[model samples]
Target: MKTFVLTALFVTIAGLSGCDRSSQGFSLPQGNAELGEQVFVKYQCLSCHTMAGYETDTENLPGSMETPVALGGQVSRIRTYPELVTSVINPSHRLAEGYEAESDQSVMPSFNDVMTVTELVNLVYFLEDHYELEPYPRTDYVSPH
Candidate 1:
Protein backbone atom coordinates (compact mmCIF):
# COMPACT_ATOMS: atom_id res chain seq x y z
CA MET A 1 0.00 0.00 0.00
CA LYS A 2 2.86 2.35 0.79
CA THR A 3 4.41 1.72 -2.59
CA PHE A 4 1.14 2.39 -4.33
CA VAL A 5 0.66 5.62 -2.45
CA LEU A 6 4.19 6.74 -3.18
CA THR A 7 3.79 5.99 -6.84
CA ALA A 8 0.55 7.91 -7.10
CA LEU A 9 2.00 10.82 -5.22
CA PHE A 10 4.99 10.90 -7.51
CA VAL A 11 2.86 10.85 -10.60
CA THR A 12 0.65 13.60 -9.31
CA ILE A 13 3.62 15.76 -8.43
CA ALA A 14 5.27 15.11 -11.77
CA GLY A 15 2.12 15.92 -13.66
CA LEU A 16 1.33 19.03 -11.66
CA SER A 17 4.79 20.58 -11.55
CA GLY A 18 5.97 19.00 -14.82
CA CYS A 19 9.42 17.40 -15.33
CA ASP A 20 11.30 20.55 -16.31
CA ARG A 21 11.82 19.19 -19.81
CA SER A 22 13.07 21.16 -22.79
CA SER A 23 14.25 20.30 -26.29
CA GLN A 24 15.54 21.72 -29.54
CA GLY A 25 14.59 18.74 -31.62
CA PHE A 26 11.95 18.15 -34.26
CA SER A 27 8.34 19.13 -33.70
CA LEU A 28 6.25 16.73 -31.67
CA PRO A 29 4.46 14.19 -33.83
CA GLN A 30 0.74 14.08 -34.52
CA GLY A 31 0.88 10.32 -34.01
CA ASN A 32 -0.65 8.87 -30.93
CA ALA A 33 1.62 8.22 -27.95
CA GLU A 34 0.21 4.71 -27.98
CA LEU A 35 1.48 4.34 -31.52
CA GLY A 36 4.75 5.95 -30.46
CA GLU A 37 5.09 3.13 -27.96
CA GLN A 38 5.24 0.77 -30.91
CA VAL A 39 7.82 2.99 -32.56
CA PHE A 40 9.84 2.98 -29.34
CA VAL A 41 9.94 -0.77 -29.06
CA LYS A 42 10.50 -1.20 -32.80
CA TYR A 43 13.54 1.05 -32.51
CA GLN A 44 14.84 -0.93 -29.50
CA CYS A 45 15.13 2.14 -27.24
CA LEU A 46 14.67 0.33 -23.93
CA SER A 47 18.29 -0.77 -24.15
CA CYS A 48 19.11 2.61 -22.58
CA HIS A 49 16.75 5.23 -21.10
CA THR A 50 13.63 4.25 -19.27
CA MET A 51 10.35 4.89 -21.12
CA ALA A 52 8.15 6.34 -18.33
CA GLY A 53 5.04 4.32 -17.47
CA TYR A 54 5.72 1.81 -20.27
CA GLU A 55 6.83 -1.63 -19.25
CA THR A 56 7.83 -4.98 -20.70
CA ASP A 57 8.11 -8.54 -19.42
CA THR A 58 11.14 -9.57 -21.43
CA GLU A 59 13.47 -7.21 -19.52
CA ASN A 60 11.76 -7.14 -16.12
CA LEU A 61 10.98 -3.44 -16.31
CA PRO A 62 9.01 -2.05 -13.37
CA GLY A 63 7.69 1.09 -15.10
CA SER A 64 9.59 4.38 -15.38
CA MET A 65 8.65 5.63 -11.92
CA GLU A 66 10.17 2.56 -10.33
CA THR A 67 13.26 2.44 -12.50
CA PRO A 68 16.24 3.12 -10.24
CA VAL A 69 18.13 4.92 -12.94
CA ALA A 70 15.45 7.22 -14.29
CA LEU A 71 16.70 10.54 -15.61
CA GLY A 72 14.64 12.36 -13.01
CA GLY A 73 16.37 10.37 -10.32
CA GLN A 74 19.77 11.11 -11.74
CA VAL A 75 19.78 14.62 -13.11
CA SER A 76 17.96 17.42 -11.38
CA ARG A 77 20.20 19.67 -13.48
CA ILE A 78 18.51 19.03 -16.79
CA ARG A 79 15.51 21.21 -17.71
CA THR A 80 15.73 21.96 -21.38
CA TYR A 81 14.79 20.18 -24.61
CA PRO A 82 18.17 20.87 -26.10
CA GLU A 83 19.63 19.34 -22.96
CA LEU A 84 17.39 16.34 -23.45
CA VAL A 85 18.22 16.12 -27.15
CA THR A 86 21.91 16.48 -26.41
CA SER A 87 21.57 13.69 -23.88
CA VAL A 88 20.27 11.49 -26.71
CA ILE A 89 22.48 12.57 -29.59
CA ASN A 90 25.67 13.32 -27.75
CA PRO A 91 25.08 11.43 -24.56
CA SER A 92 28.62 12.07 -23.55
CA HIS A 93 27.93 15.78 -23.33
CA ARG A 94 26.64 15.75 -19.77
CA LEU A 95 26.55 13.20 -17.03
CA ALA A 96 23.38 13.01 -14.99
CA GLU A 97 23.94 14.35 -11.44
CA GLY A 98 25.05 12.07 -8.60
CA TYR A 99 26.68 9.39 -10.73
CA GLU A 100 30.40 9.48 -11.36
CA ALA A 101 31.62 10.99 -14.64
CA GLU A 102 32.82 7.61 -15.81
CA SER A 103 29.40 6.12 -15.15
CA ASP A 104 28.61 6.50 -18.83
CA GLN A 105 31.22 3.85 -19.42
CA SER A 106 28.59 1.35 -18.28
CA VAL A 107 25.33 3.18 -19.06
CA MET A 108 23.80 4.97 -22.09
CA PRO A 109 25.43 3.61 -25.23
CA SER A 110 26.42 5.82 -28.14
CA PHE A 111 23.58 6.34 -30.64
CA ASN A 112 25.29 8.94 -32.78
CA ASP A 113 25.95 6.37 -35.46
CA VAL A 114 23.00 4.13 -34.83
CA MET A 115 19.77 6.17 -35.01
CA THR A 116 18.98 8.04 -38.21
CA VAL A 117 17.37 11.49 -38.27
CA THR A 118 13.82 10.26 -38.96
CA GLU A 119 14.02 7.65 -36.26
CA LEU A 120 15.39 10.25 -33.85
CA VAL A 121 12.39 12.50 -34.43
CA ASN A 122 9.96 9.66 -33.91
CA LEU A 123 11.74 8.64 -30.76
CA VAL A 124 11.59 12.20 -29.42
CA TYR A 125 7.85 12.26 -30.12
CA PHE A 126 7.44 9.07 -28.18
CA LEU A 127 9.18 10.69 -25.23
CA GLU A 128 7.56 14.14 -25.28
CA ASP A 129 4.03 13.00 -26.00
CA HIS A 130 4.03 10.03 -23.70
CA TYR A 131 6.12 11.16 -20.75
CA GLU A 132 5.40 13.87 -18.20
CA LEU A 133 7.83 16.65 -17.34
CA GLU A 134 8.22 19.92 -15.45
CA PRO A 135 7.35 23.10 -17.35
CA TYR A 136 10.00 24.62 -19.62
CA PRO A 137 10.46 26.68 -22.74
CA ARG A 138 10.03 25.14 -26.21
CA THR A 139 12.50 25.50 -29.02
CA ASP A 140 12.66 23.95 -32.48
CA TYR A 141 15.93 22.46 -33.68
CA VAL A 142 14.63 21.45 -37.07
CA SER A 143 16.26 23.42 -39.84
CA PRO A 144 14.23 25.91 -41.84
CA HIS A 145 13.95 25.85 -45.63
Candidate 2:
Protein backbone atom coordinates (compact mmCIF):
# COMPACT_ATOMS: atom_id res chain seq x y z
CA MET A 1 0.00 0.00 0.00
CA LYS A 2 2.94 2.34 0.64
CA THR A 3 4.23 1.74 -2.93
CA PHE A 4 0.81 2.59 -4.38
CA VAL A 5 0.62 5.86 -2.40
CA LEU A 6 4.12 6.87 -3.49
CA THR A 7 3.35 6.10 -7.13
CA ALA A 8 0.15 8.19 -6.96
CA LEU A 9 2.04 11.14 -5.46
CA PHE A 10 4.71 10.92 -8.16
CA VAL A 11 2.07 10.80 -10.90
CA THR A 12 0.23 13.80 -9.47
CA ILE A 13 3.43 15.86 -9.24
CA ALA A 14 4.47 14.94 -12.79
CA GLY A 15 1.05 15.84 -14.19
CA LEU A 16 1.04 19.20 -12.43
CA SER A 17 4.56 20.02 -13.63
CA GLY A 18 3.69 19.22 -17.24
CA CYS A 19 1.25 22.14 -17.40
CA ASP A 20 2.45 24.88 -19.77
CA ARG A 21 5.09 27.19 -18.36
CA SER A 22 6.59 28.36 -21.61
CA SER A 23 5.88 32.06 -21.04
CA GLN A 24 5.57 32.09 -17.28
CA GLY A 25 7.46 35.00 -15.70
CA PHE A 26 9.19 35.82 -18.99
CA SER A 27 9.92 39.47 -19.65
CA LEU A 28 11.76 41.60 -22.20
CA PRO A 29 13.56 44.87 -21.64
CA GLN A 30 11.53 48.04 -22.09
CA GLY A 31 12.68 50.01 -25.14
CA ASN A 32 12.67 53.58 -26.39
CA ALA A 33 10.71 54.18 -29.61
CA GLU A 34 12.90 57.07 -30.80
CA LEU A 35 16.11 55.07 -30.60
CA GLY A 36 14.35 52.16 -32.30
CA GLU A 37 13.65 54.32 -35.37
CA GLN A 38 17.37 55.06 -35.57
CA VAL A 39 18.10 51.34 -35.35
CA PHE A 40 15.62 50.79 -38.19
CA VAL A 41 17.37 53.32 -40.40
CA LYS A 42 20.86 52.16 -39.45
CA TYR A 43 19.87 48.63 -40.46
CA GLN A 44 18.37 49.88 -43.76
CA CYS A 45 15.04 48.10 -43.13
CA LEU A 46 13.25 50.52 -45.46
CA SER A 47 14.60 48.64 -48.44
CA CYS A 48 11.96 45.96 -47.88
CA HIS A 49 9.47 47.25 -45.34
CA THR A 50 7.30 50.35 -45.58
CA MET A 51 6.78 52.12 -42.27
CA ALA A 52 3.76 54.35 -41.86
CA GLY A 53 4.58 58.07 -41.56
CA TYR A 54 8.22 57.38 -42.32
CA GLU A 55 10.06 57.78 -45.61
CA THR A 56 13.36 56.49 -46.91
CA ASP A 57 15.41 56.91 -50.07
CA THR A 58 14.96 53.48 -51.62
CA GLU A 59 15.56 54.59 -55.20
CA ASN A 60 18.93 52.85 -55.38
CA LEU A 61 17.76 49.34 -54.41
CA PRO A 62 16.61 47.02 -57.20
CA GLY A 63 12.88 47.34 -57.70
CA SER A 64 10.79 44.24 -57.25
CA MET A 65 7.55 43.75 -59.15
CA GLU A 66 6.18 42.09 -56.06
CA THR A 67 4.79 44.28 -53.31
CA PRO A 68 6.94 44.52 -50.21
CA VAL A 69 5.39 43.83 -46.84
CA ALA A 70 3.86 46.99 -45.37
CA LEU A 71 4.75 47.05 -41.66
CA GLY A 72 2.43 49.55 -40.02
CA GLY A 73 -1.26 50.36 -40.28
CA GLN A 74 -4.73 49.53 -38.94
CA VAL A 75 -4.05 45.83 -38.78
CA SER A 76 -6.85 43.29 -38.37
CA ARG A 77 -5.26 42.07 -35.14
CA ILE A 78 -2.67 43.28 -32.69
CA ARG A 79 0.73 41.63 -32.91
CA THR A 80 2.11 40.77 -29.49
CA TYR A 81 5.65 41.67 -28.48
CA PRO A 82 6.78 38.07 -28.42
CA GLU A 83 5.58 37.54 -31.99
CA LEU A 84 7.66 40.45 -33.24
CA VAL A 85 10.70 39.20 -31.37
CA THR A 86 10.29 35.74 -32.87
CA SER A 87 9.96 37.20 -36.37
CA VAL A 88 13.31 38.95 -36.03
CA ILE A 89 15.08 36.03 -34.40
CA ASN A 90 13.47 33.33 -36.50
CA PRO A 91 12.10 34.86 -39.70
CA SER A 92 11.23 31.53 -41.24
CA HIS A 93 9.32 30.19 -38.23
CA ARG A 94 6.22 30.64 -40.35
CA LEU A 95 5.97 32.56 -43.61
CA ALA A 96 3.31 35.27 -43.72
CA GLU A 97 0.50 33.21 -45.36
CA GLY A 98 0.55 34.20 -49.06
CA TYR A 99 4.35 34.20 -49.33
CA GLU A 100 4.84 30.60 -48.22
CA ALA A 101 4.57 28.89 -51.62
CA GLU A 102 6.33 31.74 -53.40
CA SER A 103 9.63 30.65 -51.98
CA ASP A 104 10.79 27.65 -49.99
CA GLN A 105 12.95 29.98 -47.89
CA SER A 106 12.41 33.33 -46.17
CA VAL A 107 13.91 36.33 -47.94
CA MET A 108 14.37 38.10 -44.60
CA PRO A 109 17.91 37.85 -43.32
CA SER A 110 18.31 37.09 -39.64
CA PHE A 111 19.72 40.09 -37.73
CA ASN A 112 20.68 37.83 -34.82
CA ASP A 113 24.34 38.24 -35.78
CA VAL A 114 24.33 42.00 -36.42
CA MET A 115 21.90 43.44 -33.87
CA THR A 116 22.39 43.85 -30.13
CA VAL A 117 19.64 42.65 -27.76
CA THR A 118 18.74 46.23 -26.85
CA GLU A 119 18.31 47.19 -30.49
CA LEU A 120 16.06 44.21 -31.10
CA VAL A 121 13.89 45.08 -28.11
CA ASN A 122 13.61 48.69 -29.23
CA LEU A 123 12.79 47.77 -32.82
CA VAL A 124 10.03 45.47 -31.67
CA TYR A 125 8.65 48.21 -29.49
CA PHE A 126 8.60 50.65 -32.41
CA LEU A 127 6.91 48.20 -34.72
CA GLU A 128 4.36 47.11 -32.14
CA ASP A 129 3.45 50.68 -31.35
CA HIS A 130 2.53 51.40 -34.96
CA TYR A 131 -0.21 48.79 -35.27
CA GLU A 132 -3.75 49.88 -34.39
CA LEU A 133 -6.86 47.74 -34.17
CA GLU A 134 -9.39 48.19 -36.96
CA PRO A 135 -12.86 46.67 -36.97
CA TYR A 136 -13.52 43.93 -39.49
CA PRO A 137 -16.21 44.61 -42.05
CA ARG A 138 -19.69 43.31 -41.25
CA THR A 139 -21.00 40.57 -43.48
CA ASP A 140 -24.38 41.22 -45.09
CA TYR A 141 -25.29 37.73 -46.24
CA VAL A 142 -27.60 35.50 -44.21
CA SER A 143 -27.66 31.69 -44.36
CA PRO A 144 -30.29 30.33 -46.71
CA HIS A 145 -33.25 28.65 -45.00
Candidate 3:
Protein backbone atom coordinates (compact mmCIF):
# COMPACT_ATOMS: atom_id res chain seq x y z
CA MET A 1 0.00 0.00 0.00
CA LYS A 2 2.86 2.40 0.78
CA THR A 3 4.68 1.54 -2.48
CA PHE A 4 1.51 2.17 -4.52
CA VAL A 5 1.01 5.58 -2.88
CA LEU A 6 4.63 6.57 -3.55
CA THR A 7 4.41 5.55 -7.23
CA ALA A 8 1.23 7.52 -7.67
CA LEU A 9 2.79 10.61 -6.11
CA PHE A 10 5.84 10.35 -8.41
CA VAL A 11 3.65 10.01 -11.51
CA THR A 12 1.50 12.97 -10.47
CA ILE A 13 4.54 15.17 -9.95
CA ALA A 14 6.01 14.32 -13.37
CA GLY A 15 2.72 14.97 -15.12
CA LEU A 16 2.26 18.29 -13.38
CA SER A 17 5.78 19.40 -14.33
CA GLY A 18 5.21 18.73 -18.03
CA CYS A 19 2.00 20.77 -18.02
CA ASP A 20 3.77 23.98 -17.00
CA ARG A 21 6.17 24.03 -19.95
CA SER A 22 4.90 25.66 -23.18
CA SER A 23 7.47 24.33 -25.71
CA GLN A 24 5.26 21.23 -26.27
CA GLY A 25 8.36 19.05 -25.66
CA PHE A 26 10.23 20.07 -28.79
CA SER A 27 13.91 20.93 -29.13
CA LEU A 28 15.68 23.23 -31.58
CA PRO A 29 17.83 21.91 -34.40
CA GLN A 30 21.58 22.56 -34.60
CA GLY A 31 21.86 24.39 -37.91
CA ASN A 32 24.58 26.90 -38.70
CA ALA A 33 23.44 30.52 -38.37
CA GLU A 34 25.55 31.49 -41.40
CA LEU A 35 23.79 28.88 -43.47
CA GLY A 36 20.54 30.02 -41.94
CA GLU A 37 21.26 33.55 -43.18
CA GLN A 38 21.61 32.27 -46.72
CA VAL A 39 18.40 30.32 -46.35
CA PHE A 40 16.65 33.41 -45.00
CA VAL A 41 17.61 35.58 -47.96
CA LYS A 42 17.01 32.73 -50.39
CA TYR A 43 13.56 32.33 -48.86
CA GLN A 44 13.00 36.08 -49.26
CA CYS A 45 12.15 36.99 -45.62
CA LEU A 46 14.35 40.08 -45.90
CA SER A 47 11.87 41.55 -48.35
CA CYS A 48 9.43 42.69 -45.68
CA HIS A 49 10.97 42.79 -42.21
CA THR A 50 14.07 44.90 -41.56
CA MET A 51 16.62 44.30 -38.82
CA ALA A 52 17.18 47.28 -36.51
CA GLY A 53 20.30 48.74 -38.15
CA TYR A 54 22.13 46.11 -40.20
CA GLU A 55 21.54 46.73 -43.87
CA THR A 56 21.05 43.86 -46.26
CA ASP A 57 23.90 43.13 -48.66
CA THR A 58 22.21 44.33 -51.79
CA GLU A 59 25.22 44.16 -54.13
CA ASN A 60 25.14 40.40 -54.26
CA LEU A 61 21.41 40.12 -53.83
CA PRO A 62 20.06 42.80 -56.09
CA GLY A 63 16.35 43.61 -56.32
CA SER A 64 15.75 42.93 -52.62
CA MET A 65 13.27 45.17 -50.85
CA GLU A 66 15.02 48.44 -50.04
CA THR A 67 12.43 50.04 -47.81
CA PRO A 68 13.15 49.67 -44.09
CA VAL A 69 10.17 49.04 -41.84
CA ALA A 70 9.81 50.42 -38.35
CA LEU A 71 10.09 47.67 -35.76
CA GLY A 72 7.32 48.73 -33.42
CA GLY A 73 5.71 47.34 -30.25
CA GLN A 74 4.84 43.88 -31.52
CA VAL A 75 8.29 43.21 -32.99
CA SER A 76 9.99 44.52 -29.83
CA ARG A 77 8.13 42.26 -27.43
CA ILE A 78 9.34 38.86 -28.65
CA ARG A 79 12.48 37.85 -26.71
CA THR A 80 12.69 34.06 -26.80
CA TYR A 81 13.22 31.19 -29.21
CA PRO A 82 9.68 29.92 -28.66
CA GLU A 83 8.30 33.39 -29.21
CA LEU A 84 10.18 33.74 -32.51
CA VAL A 85 9.07 30.29 -33.64
CA THR A 86 5.48 31.14 -32.77
CA SER A 87 5.72 34.36 -34.76
CA VAL A 88 6.95 32.51 -37.84
CA ILE A 89 4.60 29.54 -37.63
CA ASN A 90 1.62 31.55 -36.47
CA PRO A 91 2.13 35.08 -37.74
CA SER A 92 -1.50 36.05 -37.26
CA HIS A 93 -1.10 35.45 -33.51
CA ARG A 94 0.74 38.76 -33.02
CA LEU A 95 0.35 41.45 -35.60
CA ALA A 96 3.34 43.74 -36.26
CA GLU A 97 2.95 47.25 -34.87
CA GLY A 98 1.58 49.88 -37.29
CA TYR A 99 0.07 46.90 -39.09
CA GLU A 100 -2.63 46.00 -36.58
CA ALA A 101 -5.94 46.19 -38.37
CA GLU A 102 -8.47 43.97 -40.08
CA SER A 103 -7.31 45.22 -43.46
CA ASP A 104 -3.62 46.05 -43.00
CA GLN A 105 -2.85 42.36 -42.77
CA SER A 106 0.40 40.44 -42.46
CA VAL A 107 2.39 40.17 -45.66
CA MET A 108 4.48 37.42 -44.10
CA PRO A 109 3.69 34.35 -46.12
CA SER A 110 2.66 31.13 -44.39
CA PHE A 111 5.78 28.94 -44.53
CA ASN A 112 4.44 26.46 -41.96
CA ASP A 113 3.62 24.12 -44.82
CA VAL A 114 6.77 24.81 -46.84
CA MET A 115 9.65 25.08 -44.35
CA THR A 116 11.07 21.82 -43.07
CA VAL A 117 11.43 21.20 -39.34
CA THR A 118 15.16 21.88 -39.51
CA GLU A 119 14.66 25.00 -41.60
CA LEU A 120 12.05 26.26 -39.16
CA VAL A 121 14.40 25.85 -36.21
CA ASN A 122 17.26 27.53 -38.03
CA LEU A 123 15.06 30.39 -39.14
CA VAL A 124 13.82 30.93 -35.60
CA TYR A 125 17.36 31.12 -34.27
CA PHE A 126 18.48 33.45 -37.01
CA LEU A 127 15.68 35.91 -36.43
CA GLU A 128 15.97 35.80 -32.65
CA ASP A 129 19.71 36.47 -32.77
CA HIS A 130 19.59 39.17 -35.41
CA TYR A 131 16.59 41.41 -34.81
CA GLU A 132 15.44 42.52 -31.37
CA LEU A 133 12.48 44.67 -30.50
CA GLU A 134 13.99 45.99 -27.28
CA PRO A 135 17.28 47.92 -27.59
CA TYR A 136 16.14 48.40 -31.19
CA PRO A 137 16.83 51.82 -32.62
CA ARG A 138 13.72 53.82 -33.37
CA THR A 139 15.09 56.13 -36.03
CA ASP A 140 12.38 57.93 -37.94
CA TYR A 141 12.64 58.21 -41.70
CA VAL A 142 12.40 61.79 -42.87
CA SER A 143 11.30 62.61 -46.39
CA PRO A 144 13.07 65.58 -47.91
CA HIS A 145 10.62 68.30 -48.93
Candidate 4:
Protein backbone atom coordinates (compact mmCIF):
# COMPACT_ATOMS: atom_id res chain seq x y z
CA MET A 1 0.00 0.00 0.00
CA LYS A 2 2.77 2.39 0.94
CA THR A 3 4.72 1.59 -2.22
CA PHE A 4 1.64 2.09 -4.33
CA VAL A 5 0.89 5.46 -2.76
CA LEU A 6 4.45 6.64 -3.19
CA THR A 7 4.56 5.54 -6.79
CA ALA A 8 1.26 7.19 -7.61
CA LEU A 9 2.35 10.42 -6.00
CA PHE A 10 5.66 10.34 -7.87
CA VAL A 11 3.94 9.72 -11.18
CA THR A 12 1.61 12.67 -10.63
CA ILE A 13 4.52 14.97 -9.90
CA ALA A 14 6.48 13.70 -12.88
CA GLY A 15 3.56 14.26 -15.23
CA LEU A 16 3.39 17.90 -14.18
CA SER A 17 7.00 18.41 -15.20
CA GLY A 18 9.32 17.77 -18.14
CA CYS A 19 10.51 14.23 -18.67
CA ASP A 20 11.25 11.61 -21.36
CA ARG A 21 10.96 7.90 -20.66
CA SER A 22 10.28 4.91 -22.85
CA SER A 23 11.78 1.45 -22.96
CA GLN A 24 11.46 -1.59 -25.19
CA GLY A 25 12.59 -5.13 -24.43
CA PHE A 26 15.97 -4.45 -25.99
CA SER A 27 18.94 -3.55 -23.81
CA LEU A 28 22.53 -2.77 -24.69
CA PRO A 29 25.74 -3.63 -22.86
CA GLN A 30 27.10 -1.01 -20.47
CA GLY A 31 29.17 1.50 -22.39
CA ASN A 32 32.07 3.87 -21.71
CA ALA A 33 30.90 7.47 -21.21
CA GLU A 34 34.43 8.78 -21.89
CA LEU A 35 34.44 7.40 -25.41
CA GLY A 36 30.90 8.69 -25.80
CA GLU A 37 32.16 12.21 -25.14
CA GLN A 38 34.65 11.80 -27.96
CA VAL A 39 31.92 10.57 -30.28
CA PHE A 40 29.79 13.59 -29.33
CA VAL A 41 32.58 15.93 -30.35
CA LYS A 42 33.41 13.94 -33.46
CA TYR A 43 29.85 14.24 -34.66
CA GLN A 44 29.67 17.91 -33.72
CA CYS A 45 26.42 17.43 -31.84
CA LEU A 46 27.01 20.80 -30.20
CA SER A 47 26.05 22.54 -33.40
CA CYS A 48 22.37 22.10 -32.66
CA HIS A 49 22.33 20.65 -29.16
CA THR A 50 24.02 21.58 -25.90
CA MET A 51 25.04 19.32 -23.02
CA ALA A 52 26.42 20.28 -19.65
CA GLY A 53 30.14 21.16 -19.51
CA TYR A 54 30.54 20.81 -23.27
CA GLU A 55 31.82 23.97 -24.97
CA THR A 56 29.64 25.58 -27.63
CA ASP A 57 31.11 26.86 -30.86
CA THR A 58 27.92 26.64 -32.87
CA GLU A 59 28.48 30.03 -34.41
CA ASN A 60 31.81 28.91 -35.82
CA LEU A 61 30.38 25.71 -37.22
CA PRO A 62 29.33 25.81 -40.87
CA GLY A 63 25.71 24.93 -40.14
CA SER A 64 24.22 25.81 -36.74
CA MET A 65 20.70 26.09 -35.50
CA GLU A 66 19.50 29.43 -34.24
CA THR A 67 18.45 28.06 -30.89
CA PRO A 68 20.46 25.14 -29.60
CA VAL A 69 18.58 22.36 -27.86
CA ALA A 70 19.67 21.52 -24.34
CA LEU A 71 20.48 17.87 -23.65
CA GLY A 72 21.13 16.93 -20.02
CA GLY A 73 20.21 18.40 -16.68
CA GLN A 74 17.85 17.83 -13.76
CA VAL A 75 14.75 15.98 -14.95
CA SER A 76 11.58 14.94 -13.18
CA ARG A 77 11.98 11.31 -14.21
CA ILE A 78 14.55 8.85 -15.45
CA ARG A 79 15.44 8.94 -19.16
CA THR A 80 15.63 5.25 -19.84
CA TYR A 81 18.38 3.87 -22.06
CA PRO A 82 15.97 2.61 -24.72
CA GLU A 83 14.36 6.04 -24.99
CA LEU A 84 17.71 7.75 -25.27
CA VAL A 85 18.81 5.26 -27.91
CA THR A 86 15.63 5.83 -29.82
CA SER A 87 16.09 9.57 -29.49
CA VAL A 88 19.54 9.39 -31.03
CA ILE A 89 18.64 6.98 -33.79
CA ASN A 90 15.20 8.34 -34.60
CA PRO A 91 14.92 11.92 -33.43
CA SER A 92 11.57 12.37 -35.12
CA HIS A 93 9.84 9.96 -32.77
CA ARG A 94 9.07 12.75 -30.29
CA LEU A 95 9.63 16.38 -30.93
CA ALA A 96 10.66 18.67 -28.11
CA GLU A 97 7.33 20.11 -26.88
CA GLY A 98 8.04 23.83 -27.01
CA TYR A 99 10.17 23.76 -30.15
CA GLU A 100 7.84 22.03 -32.59
CA ALA A 101 6.85 25.35 -34.09
CA GLU A 102 10.45 26.41 -34.67
CA SER A 103 10.92 23.76 -37.29
CA ASP A 104 8.47 21.71 -39.29
CA GLN A 105 10.41 18.64 -38.26
CA SER A 106 13.38 17.85 -36.06
CA VAL A 107 16.35 19.88 -37.21
CA MET A 108 18.73 17.09 -36.25
CA PRO A 109 20.26 15.39 -39.23
CA SER A 110 20.63 11.63 -39.55
CA PHE A 111 23.90 10.10 -38.41
CA ASN A 112 22.80 6.53 -39.05
CA ASP A 113 25.06 6.19 -42.06
CA VAL A 114 28.16 7.60 -40.40
CA MET A 115 28.03 6.88 -36.66
CA THR A 116 29.29 3.47 -35.57
CA VAL A 117 27.28 1.23 -33.27
CA THR A 118 29.96 1.55 -30.60
CA GLU A 119 29.77 5.32 -30.83
CA LEU A 120 26.00 5.26 -30.48
CA VAL A 121 26.22 3.07 -27.39
CA ASN A 122 28.91 5.24 -25.90
CA LEU A 123 26.94 8.41 -26.60
CA VAL A 124 23.93 6.96 -24.86
CA TYR A 125 26.11 6.12 -21.88
CA PHE A 126 27.42 9.67 -21.73
CA LEU A 127 23.86 11.01 -21.88
CA GLU A 128 22.68 8.54 -19.23
CA ASP A 129 25.35 9.82 -16.90
CA HIS A 130 24.37 13.46 -17.28
CA TYR A 131 20.63 13.46 -16.56
CA GLU A 132 19.94 13.87 -12.84
CA LEU A 133 16.49 13.18 -11.44
CA GLU A 134 15.08 16.17 -9.61
CA PRO A 135 14.27 15.60 -5.94
CA TYR A 136 10.60 15.04 -5.28
CA PRO A 137 8.92 17.09 -2.63
CA ARG A 138 6.49 15.05 -0.58
CA THR A 139 2.93 16.23 -0.52
CA ASP A 140 1.46 16.98 2.91
CA TYR A 141 -2.03 16.00 3.96
CA VAL A 142 -4.12 16.72 7.02
CA SER A 143 -7.22 14.93 8.19
CA PRO A 144 -10.42 16.93 8.28
CA HIS A 145 -11.77 17.57 11.77
Model 3: colliding residue pairs: 76-133
Order of the predicted models by lDDT, top scorer first: 4, 2, 3, 1
Q: Kindly give the stretch of ten consecutive residues in candidate 4 with the minimal lDDT sum.
A: 16-25
- The TM-scores of all predictions, comma-separated, are 0.47, 0.70, 0.54, 0.70
Off by over 4 Å in 3: 1-25, 52-78, 101-105, 131-145
Candidate 2 local lDDT, 94-117, one digit each (tens): 886555534556666779999999
lDDT of 1 by residue, 18-74 (tens): 443223342322324455566568755664445456453336432322333443322
By TM-score, the candidates rank as 4, 2, 3, 1
List candidate 4 stretches off by more than 4 Å.
1-24, 60-65, 101-104, 137-145
Model 2: lDDT of residue 140: 88
Best by TM-score: 4
- Give candidate 4's whole-model lDDT: 0.78
Choose the strongest candidate by lDDT: 4
- Model 3 residue 111 CA deviation (Å) reads 1.0
Task: Residues 57-142, candidate 4: write the lDDT tens digits.
Answer: 67844343456788889887879888898988988788876555345566677799999998998999898899998888456899
Stretches of candidate 2 above 4 Å error?
Answer: 1-25, 60-65, 97-103, 143-145
